[model samples]
Target: MKKLFIMLLTAFVFAVVNPTKSEAKVMYDGAEVVKGQTGKMTFKKDIKVYKKNPNGSFDSLVVKRNNFFKTYDIEKYDGKTFYQMGQYRVQATDLVVFKEVPIEIRSSFYNDPIYININRDNGMGSYGYYFLRYQLTFLDNGYVDHCFSDGDEGTDCDRYLGTDFKITERIEREYGMRYEISKNAEGKGVPLKESKTEKIMEKGSIVFAKGLEINGYLNVGIEGNDQEYFWVPVNLLKPVGDK
Candidate 1:
């Protein structure tokens, strides 16, 4: 009876220690994209999709370039990027990164032309030379009658949106529309023309939606306008919440 018990114990220990390679579970490091961030995917060649199981070895599907999809929730495995698309984990390459647009100046200010007269006596007799300089005007439009300058006051000053307005959220995932500013950069609320705008929003397109804390602003494609971009308030944007 003692010999039989010993043999049974040895068999149990060997079975537990010597599991098959296929039965061994593989562990992966955990990583994910920042919550609520949007990402675009592009691939140079066809890629295989895998299940997010412990082994992560089973092939579930194949995704070609023509039908590549975007990934909202991303993870990293073995130095490759993976997204939780559909029911399985899809590996993605050639990932395009979207950076947050930063706001530079909060309060609105405009450029004003200033002329200075300098009398320099460089041994060639004193003569006045006129030079131009720009100064920042910090007062709100309604408060001041006109722009103040050394030689001129009550002159028209270019108005910019006050800094009180902010972008509460961004609309990422959804297609963004392309536009052209109706007027020059100084024209904040210029009306948009339907003819010059692209109906569909492309990747990296800038859009300021309405229904925000303040009205959103956007310029899809400005026709003949020298300005690359203009700030507009958008209040009507609903972006995915912070993940």
Candidate 2:
């Protein structure tokens, strides 16, 4: 009977010393974690996601920057910290909290009513070449107006007097890689050729009439003029009253 009791005690001690997989809990560093937290991430370039193993090595996962995964747990393994994002592990430095800010440009011309140049850079080289993407000039009476000139040098006969419009939505639209526009939210996907001649606000000048945010673009009315408007990109247009 004593030998039977000793055998039972030995088995219990062995079971206690070697816990099964079902008895083990997830651990960070040397401490046990019951649950994890969550966070967001953004990237500038494509990156690979990795899965950690018990042997302190990583296995590649078929994930990239386009994959959206929120991290839930933070763990330290092999002296490096990683975010437990979903079922994958990613280096903490690889994640970022992103925010987009609008770009602003001021008129370089010095006059009572300055000529606004709506020029965009060709996607090439350092700084690239600039040509007028849209046209605007001061009227003979110093009234600001939108004008058209073929390429850069031509008669400014084609003119549109801007008018005040309403704001609905404003979105950041990109052209090539260097230029961005404030596209109207409502008129998206409808080709501009089918739309009316609305002045798209450029990076160099503010010559439009109405400053209404229709879609993702801002339709701003020219100062003192109610007949013409410039449709500027919401991301590039400066706030009103910002000197």
- Tell me the whole-model lDDT of each prediction, alpha carbons only: 0.34, 0.38
Query: Scored by Cα lDDT, where does model 2 land?
Result: 0.38
Error of 1 at 135 (Å): 32
Highest lDDT scorer: 2
Q: What is the TM-score of each candidate against the true structure?
A: 0.22, 0.21
Question: Tens digits of per-residue lDDT for model 1 on 1-243?
Answer: 999999999999998999656632321122222322223354556666666556655656766754444444344324454555555655544532322111122111113222111112122212111112223333534211113444545455433222111212222322233332222233232222111232333333333322212113333333244444333323222243222
What's model 1's lDDT at 124? 22
For model 1, state the Cα shift of residue 127 in Å: 67
RMSD of each: 26.5, 25.6
What number of backbone clashes does candidate 2 have, counting pairs of residues 3 or more apart or in separate chains?
32
lDDT per residue (tens digit) for residues 1-243 in model 2: 999999999999989998665745543333333322233455545777777688988887655554445444343334454555676766756344321110101121111211211111212111111112133443444223444455768745533211101111222233211222333322212111223344433444533323233334444444445565444445665443323
- Taking all chains together, the TM-score of candidate 1 against the true structure is 0.22
